[model samples]
Target: MNSTKGSMINEKKGRIGCVKWHGDLMDTRTFSNAGQDLYVRVNETILAQYAKSSGSLTKKAKLAISIVSVLLFFLVVFLVYWLAKRKSKGKERPDKFVSRVLTGSTYFEKSTADLDDENTINSSELPFFNLSTIYVATNNFSASNKLGTGGFGSVYKGVFSNGKEIAVKRLSKHSGQGIEEFKNEVVLIAKLQHRNLVRILGCCVQDEEKMLIYEYVPNKSLDYFIFNETNRALLDWTRRIFRGDQNEANTNRVVGTYGYMSPEYAMEGLFSVKSDVYSFGILLLEIISGRKNTGYYNETYPDSNLVGHVWNLWGEDNALKIVDSSLVDSFHFNQVARCIQIALLCVQEDPTERPTMSAVLVMLSNDAALPQPGKPPFLVKKSGTIEDNSINYVTCTIVSTR
Candidate 1:
C-alpha cells in the first residue's frame, strides 16, 4: 500500500477507495497507480481550514445571543419605568382636580372648555361664593333665623345686607359627604334650572364646614302645617294632600326627616315611587291622628314608634281609638278606620304591596274594602339602640352597586 498525505490530488492514480472513520474530523481519499495496490490520501490543510471556520461561526452565534439578551434587559427596565411614571400621574389627578375646584374653576370646565360652550353651563346664576360670604349673610347661623332641620343638617334664613333672601343649609360635621361628592353635587346643581327645584344660588366650603345656599322662597314645609293643630283646621288638609309624582332615583346619600324615610330607602339606598308611598303613609297617619310620627312613644310597646303602635291598634279593630280628638267627632268612624287601613297599605314592608298615589286617591274617594297590608317597617332595639329590622327581607334591593 502506498500512502499520500496533505493533498487530495495524487501525482499518479488508478483505483478508488473510501472508508468511514468513527471519531475524528477527517477528509480522506483513495488512489492507485497503474492497477497497483490501493493508495490513501489525507488532507490536513483542508481539515484545519474547516475547523477554524466552524469555531469562528460558533463565536459569532454566542456574540449575537449576548447582544440580544442585553437589549431585552434594557427593554424590560424601560417598560417598568414607564408604568411607574403612569401610576404616579394617576395618583396626582384627583388632588389636582380638587385643587382646581377650590381655587377657581373645576378641572372638568378647564379640560372641556374647548369642547363645550360657556353658555351650555347653566351655572351663570350659581355663584360659588366663599364661606365668609355665607357666614356674614347667615348672621353666624343664628337659631332664630333657622328655617328647619333636616336629615343632613339645619337650614337657616340668610338676609344679605343688600336685602337678598337666601336659605343656607349647613351640612352636619358627621355627614359622610366627601369632597368629591360635594364637588359633584355643586356641579350638578349648578347645571339644573327648574321652577320646582329651588334655584341653588351658591355653596360654602371651608375647613370642616360645608353649606348649600338656595334662593329663599317663603313657604312652610308640608310637615309644618300638617302637624300644627291651629293651622290644621284652616285647610281641608286631607284633600290637599295628594300632590304630584316624580321618577324615583336611588342615591348613595340618603337624606330626609327620620320619620319620613322608607324602609328600603333608609337602610339599603333603594328608592322608587314606593318610597313616596311610604312617606305618604306617614303623612296620612299624621293627618288622621294629628300627631308627629317620629318621636311618639308608646308605653305598651318598647322601642316602637307610631308605626308599630298604629299597627297594634289596627290589628285589634280599635283603629279609631288612636284618632286625633279633633278628628274624632268631625269624621265618621268608618271613614277614619278606612283611612287608617289605606295608610297601613302605604307603609307595608313590601314596596310592591303599597298602593300608588293614584290608587290611594281611588281608595280615599271610594269605600271599597281595601286589601290588607303586610307588616309595616319599624325600628326596634335588639342591642340597646334603635335599629331598622327591614334588612331581614330576602328581596329588598338598591338600584345597583357603584
Candidate 2:
C-alpha cells in the first residue's frame, strides 16, 4: 500500500510541470501577435498622411494651369481687336466734306438753315456758291446757256471763274410741284454714288429759287443718241446702262413725262419700282428699234404701237427686223435677241411676272434659260378724247429734246 501511494504522487508532479510549459508558450505567441498588429497600424497612418500631401500638390498645379490658360486667351482676343481697329482706321480716312454733307453740319456747328444764308456760305463744307456767283457763271440765265429742259426743270451750262464747267438745273417758277421735286432731287442725288447714275456736285436755294449743279455728262442723255437717226450709230458695240430704284414713292398726282409713264401710274396714279421697270422696257424697245413709242405710228397696222409692233414681229420669228437698221449687222444677234426677250418680259401686264433688277443683271450676264413672257401692256392710242378712265390727267410738259 505505501509503494502504490509514491507512484501516484510522482505522476501528479510531472503533469503540473507539463501545464506550466504550455502556459509559457501561449504568453510568447500572444506578445508576438500584438507587436505585429502595432507595426501594421503605424504603416497605415504614414501612408494616409503621404497620400493627403500628394492630393494637395495636384490641386495647386491644376489651379495654376487654369489661371495661366485664361490669361493667354484674353491676351490673344485683345491683340486681334486692336489690330483690326488699326487696319480699318488706316483704310477709311474720314473726309470732312463727306462728313459735313452726311451730318448736315459743318465744323463750326452751324446748322444747314444757318449755312443757307449767302453771308454764312463759308461755314459749309459743300462748295456753296452764292446767287451772284451762279448768275455770273450762267451768264444771268442766258437762253444760249440752256442745255436742256426736263419734267423737273431746265438745265443750264455754267462756267465758273476758274473755268470749271458745271450743269445747273434751275427749278421753274411755273412748276407747281417744283419745291417737292427740288427736295427730292437734292435728297436722292446726294445719297447716290454710282458710275451709271449722274453725280450731284452741289445745290443752291435762295428765296424762291432752287438749283442743282451736276457734273457735265458730255455724251448727254440716253434718249439723245438712241432717238436720233444720225447719233444712233454711235451706240454700236456699246451696252445701254440703266439703274432702277426698288423703293416706291407714292404721289398724290402723276408727275412724269407722257410716253415713259406706266399704265398703272398714268391711270390710277399708283406707281412702284415695277412702274419704273415698265418705263425702262419701253425705253429699251425704243433703243432697239430706233423709234419713239408715242410719236411713231405704223401706217400698215395703224393702231399698233411700238410695243405691239415688236410683239407681232417676235411671234412671227422675225424679231431681228425690229433691231435698229444701223445696229442690225453690227450688234451681236444673240445679245440683241436676249435683250428683246428681257424687254418683253419686263413689260408684262402683271408686274410680278417681271424679274427683279438683280435677276435681270444675272440674265444679262449669263446665258441661262429665260422664262416665257406673257402679253405686254397695250399702248393706248392718243385720240382727242381720254381713253381708259375719267381721272384728271395733268401732264408735266417739260420735255427733254436734247
Q: Which candidate is the best by lDDT?
A: 2
lDDT of 2 at 226: 65
Candidate 2 lDDT by residue in tens digits, 194-225: 44454445666665567776655554655666
Q: What is the per-residue lDDT of model 1 for residues 160-195, given as tens digits with 9 covering 90 to 100?
A: 666778887777777544444455455444443344
Model 1 worst lDDT run, 10 consecutive residues? 393-402
* Candidate 1 deviant stretches above 4 angstroms: 1-127, 130-133, 148-151, 160-164, 173-199, 206-209, 217-219, 222-259, 294-299, 329-335, 365-369, 379-383, 386-402
Clashing pairs in 1: 14-32
How large is the C-alpha RMSD of every model relative to the true structure? 13.6, 22.1
**Cand. 1 Cα-lDDT:** 0.61
lDDT of 2: 0.62
Q: What are the runs in model 2 whose C-alpha is more than 4 Å off?
A: 1-128, 176-180, 187-195, 239-255, 385-402
Q: What is the C-alpha lDDT of each candidate?
A: 0.61, 0.62
Q: Give candidate 2's total backbone clashes.
A: 0
